[model samples]
Target: MNGLCLVTGANGHLGNTLVRALLGQGHRVRAGVRDIGNHAPFAGLDCELVYAELLDSSALDKALEGVQVLFQVAAVFKHWARNPEAEIVEPNLVGTRRVLEAASRAGVQRVVYVSSVAAVGHDGTALDETHWNTESENAYYKSKILSEQAAWQCAEALGLNMVSVLPSAMVGPNAGSLTDTMGFLQTVRQRQMPFDPGFRFNFVDVRDVADGMIRAAEKGRAGQRYILANVRSSPLSDLIAAANTHTPGYRQPVSAPRWLLLGVAWLQERWARCVGKPAQLLLSQVRLFHNVAQEYDITKAKNELGFNPRSPEVALQQAFAYLYRQAHQPYEDLPQAAVQTVSSSRA
Candidate 1:
C-alpha cells in the first residue's frame, strides 16, 4: 500500500492536489494521465508518468503494473451532453470497470475510489453514506452512482481492498480551469447570476479532500464508503457574503421564485442547444436548488479516518485569490498586507 502508487486523472483538480500530497509524503507515485505530454505541472517532481486512458482498458494493465495502491480519479464530469451514453454514462461506467479490472490484473493491494455527493441521495433531509442516489435523472449524478456501484461490485468479485470517498463540491487554491465548484463562484463573481435560490449545499477544500482520500487509503476500512466534506452546509447567501468579504462591491443575487428560475433555465437551455453547447444552468440544476437544502454528515470519516476539513469561507477566500491571480488581475480588496498575513498563517 505504500510503494509505487498509481494516481489516475493526474491533471485534474483533485488528482493534481492528491499527487502533490503523495509526493510530499515521500511516496513514489506513478501519475496516470491520458497524455503524458500535457503534464507540465508535474515536471520538476520526480514521479513516473504513464499514459493511461480508462476507456482503453488494454493500456491500463501496463499503467497499473508494479503499483501497490491505485487512486482512481479519472471520469467525465458533465451535466448534459448531446450524447449522454457516449460522453457521460459510458465513460464513467465502462471506464471505471476497466480500471478496476486492470487493477485486479496488476495485483494491486488497495484502491481509493473518488466518488461524489451527487451519487448519494437524500429523503428531504440530511444524508449520509447509506443513501444511494436512485431517483436522480441528472447524467452526472447517474454516472457517479453507477460508477461507484460498479467499483464496489468489481472490488468484491476480485477481492481487492477498496474504499470509496464521496467529496462534496470542492473549492481551494489549486482548482483547475474546469472545476464546477470554482465555476459556481465565478458565475456569482461576474454578476452572471441574477437571483439566488437560498438553498445550501456542502462544500470542502480541495486540499482537505485530497488529504482525506489519502487517509482513506491508509486507514479506512475496505469495502466502506466515507463522505469527505465540511461539517456544515452554507447557504447561497453565506457564500456570497464570503466572496464579498474578500472582494468589495460583489453583487449579491435577489431571491427568485421557483417558476422564474425554471423559465430562465429553459431559455438558457434553448439558447445553448442553438449554439451547440451545454447550458450554463440546466433545468435539472435549477430543480435541485428548488429542493430542500442538503446537509452532509462527515462524522464517519472523522471518527474513522480522522479527516478534518477547513471552513468553507477560508476555502472560498483562497479560491478568490487563485482566480484573480490566474487572470492576472490585482486584488484591490485583498490588500498586500492582508494577503501576506493570510498566506504566512496558512503556510
Candidate 2:
C-alpha cells in the first residue's frame, strides 16, 4: 500500500476512474493500456502511461516493475460473441492467470481483481458474498466466475496477496466507451425498447465501485470477496421513472408477458446471427431476468471496508444526464444546471 499502483485497462470505464481515485489520494500511479495511443481517458491526468496488454507477458512484467499494488481490471465483457470460448472465456481465464503470475514474478505486494456481481449466484432471495454463481448459462457471467476462481487458485499457488471485488450494474459519468449498462440507458432514452422485460438490476456508481476497489487494496483480507453493490434491486420501471425526472419526453415501455419476450428475443438472436452482429437482446438475458432477483446484502463490505455507496437514483440521474449530453452536444455545451446536478451528486 505504500508503493506505486499499476492499473490495467486504464482506458476502461472503471479502470480510468480507479486511476483518478488513486491519483487523488496522492498515490503514484502507472496507467496500463493495450494501446498507449488510445489514452483520451487519461488526458491531462498526472499518471505514467504504459503499454500493458494482459496476454503480453513481457509488457505486464515491465508494467509491474515498480508497482506494489496491482489493479487487474482488464477483461472481455461482451454477452454475445462469435466464439464464446475464444473471445470471452479464454481471454478472461487465461489472461487472469497470466497477469497474476506476472504480478507474483514482479513481487507485487497486493492485487485487487475486479469481478462482477454476475459471479454471485442469484436466487429469488437476497444474495451475499458467500454465494457462487454456478447456475449462470450466459457466457460473460460464466467467464467472471471461472476467471475469479482461477485467479484465486493462481494467487494461492504463487503466494500472492489478492482480493476480488464484485460490482453490480455500474452507472456514472466519463465512461470511455458505451458499456452495456449505459447502452441500455441509451435505448430507453431513444425509446427503442418496444416492451419492458421486467428486468431488475442492482445499480451502483462506477466511481463508488472504484473507491471500493481502492479500499479493498488498502485493507481487504487475502482471498476475500466483497460485493460492491446497492442494498436493494430496482425494477426497470424505477429506472425509467428516474430517467424521466431528468429528461422528460419519453414514456416507459409497457410490460410484456414472459412468453412474448422470449419469442421476441429468439427472433432478435436469429437476426443478429444472420447480420453478423451481437444481438441487442438474448434469450439467456431474458430468462435470467425472470428467474433471478438482483437483490444483495452489502453489510460485509460496509463493516469491513467502510464502503458506503450513494443511492441508485443519484447514479441513474447522473448517467442519464451524461448520456443525453453525449447524444446531443459536447460535454462543455451541456446546460449549466445539468452539469451542476451531476457534480453535486458526486459531492
Candidate 3:
C-alpha cells in the first residue's frame, strides 16, 4: 500500500490513463516512456519519466529500483508498424521479462499484468482464464500469449507475485487525443460503415481497467489471472445506434457478408506485407469478429477485485461522446472510417 509503482508505455492511451489513476490514488509512480524527450504527456502530473526499453535489461533495472508494484500495460499492433518483432514482441515480451526479473530481484510485492482477452479467447464465445488463443494467427496475439506465459512461468519459478488482467476491446477516451477505437466510431457517426456492426464484444472502461490493476495489486492472489469483463456487450448494430443518439442521424452497421470480411482480410494482409506494415484485419481480429460472443464470467473479479463496469450501451456512449466532444463535431463528416456509418442508401 505504501510503495512506489512503475508503469511502462506511459505515452500510450491506456498507459496515460493508468498513470493518472495511480496519481489520483496518491501512489508514487515511476513512468517509463520510450521517448523521454517528450515530457509533455506526464506534464502537470506527479510522476517520474525515464527512458526504458524492454530489450535493455540494465535500463529496465534502473527504472524498477524502489518500485514495489509493476503495472505492465504496454501494447503494440503489428498492422500499425512495419516490424512486429522490434515493435510488438521485443518490448512486450522482453520488456515484460526485464520488469518481472527486476521486480523479483527488488522483492516487489506484486505485479499487475495487463494482458488481452485475445490471449484467453479463441473461437471466442466468452472464454475464461482457462482458455488461450491459438498461435496460428496474428503476431500480436501470439506476443501477448507468450508474454503471459513467460510472466506466469517466472512467477512460479521466482516466487514473484503476479496477477494478470485480460480486458476486452478498450473503447474509451484517452490522452494524446486519440484511441484505436476512435476510427471505428467515426465511421458510425458519419454514416460511412460499409458493413453492418452486427457483432458482439464486451466492454471494460479504461478507468475500470485502471482500478482493476490496483485491485490486483492489493487483493489478487499471486499466480492468478482475472478476466476484467463487463456486465454487457452492445450488439455491433446497437453500438452504431448509440452513436446516432448524440449525432442525430448517424449511420449504422451494414451487413458486410462473412465472405466479404474474408476477402478484406486477404487484401489486408497483402497490402500490409507489400508496404511492410501490419495487416489491419489480421487473422486474430477477423477470428475475433467471428468467434467473440457470449457474456464473460467475471464473478471472480466482482467477488475478489471488486471490479464492475458500466453497461455496454453506457460504455459505448461514454466512448463516442468523449470522442465527439474532443473532436468538437456533431458526428457528421467524419474524415475516417472508425465505425460503420449510415449510408445515403439508408431507409
Candidate 4:
C-alpha cells in the first residue's frame, strides 16, 4: 500500500514521529502543516509539505487529492477547557467534521484519528474504546467525544474507512510543539512538585504510538477503535523515580499536600486563560488525578495490530535523548554503554 498518505499536523510531536516512520516505510507523505516556512528541520526529509488549516475545507481537499490514508493529528488540548461555544467547537469538533467531509469526498481509503483516553472519561474501571466522556464535564472533553462520534457516524454512512487510536499520555522522542505529557515531565524533572496527587498514568512512547498509527493505515479494521498503551501504569511516585534517571537536578520521590494542590490548580487554571499560557491544572484535571486506580486494556491492539508499546524505562531514555538533542547536545557523545542499552531496548 505505498500510496500517497496525508498526515495532518505534521509539525506536531506525534505527527513528526509518524511522518518519519511512514517515510521509512517508503510511503509518499504529504505533510499538512499550518505553515510551510517553519519546517526548517524537515527541509531535506522526503515529504511534501502542503499548507492547510482544518477550518479550510478547500485546502483540506487539495491535500487529500489521490491520498489513501489521512491522519488527523491536530487538536486543541488544554488544561481548563474554554468557554463560549465557538472557542471550543470550531477547531476540534468542526474541524474534525470538515476533515471527514474532505476525506469522504476525495475517496480516501481510511483515516487514523489520534485521540486521547481522557476523551472517554475522567474516572472509571479503565475505560475502553466503547466508553466516552460525559458531555457535562467541560468543553474540551465534550468536544473530543462529539468529534469521535461524528467521525464514526460520517464514516459509517459514507462508507469511509476510519479507525481511532487512543493513547493515555504520549512521551518519548518529540519534535514540534510541546505537549501536556512533556510539560509535566519537564516540571517534574525541574523539581516542581505541585499539589502532588500520587495518581497513576499509563504512558506509551510517542514512537510506539506513531508506529501503531502507521500500522493502522495498513492493517486497521474499518470502523474500529484501538487503545495503545504500555504494559503497566506508573504511579506519580514511581514516575518521578523513573524521571530522575534522565534528569540531572530532579528530586526523587516528592510529594505535596492534596489540599494545597487544589488551591494551586485553581489559580493556575485562571492564569492560564488570562495569559494565553498552557494551564497547569483544572477542575476536570483535579478529578482526573483524584481517581488513582483506573486502568485500560491494550490486548486488542496487541492481538490485532501487532502493537508493542515500549517499556517506561526505554521510553524515558528516548524522550531525554530527544530533549537533549533539542538543546544541541551530541547524542554520539553520550556514554557508550547508555547508547548500547537504548539501542538494545528498541530492538
Model 2 global lDDT (CA atoms, 0 to 1):
0.84
Q: What shift in Å separates residue 68 of candidate 3 from its native position after superposition? A: 1.2
lDDT of 3: 0.72
The CA lDDT of each predicted structure is 0.79, 0.84, 0.72, 0.73
lDDT of 3 by residue, 2-84 (tens): 89888888777778888888989899888776677665566567677776566666677777778889888766634355566
Model 2 regions lying over 4 Å from their true place: 329-347
Candidate 1's TM-score reads 0.91
**Candidate 1 error regions (>4 Å):** 329-347
RMSD of each: 7.0, 6.1, 9.1, 7.1
How high is each candidate's TM-score? 0.91, 0.93, 0.86, 0.87
The 10 consecutive residues of candidate 1 with the worst lDDT sum are 338-347
In model 4, the clashing pairs are none
Residue 93 CA error for candidate 1 (Å)?
Answer: 0.3
What TM-score does candidate 4 get on C-alpha atoms?
0.87
Instruction: Give the higher-lDDT candidate: 1 or 2.
Output: 2
> Which candidate ranks first by lDDT, i.e. highest?
2
Ranking under TM-score, best-scoring first?
2, 1, 4, 3
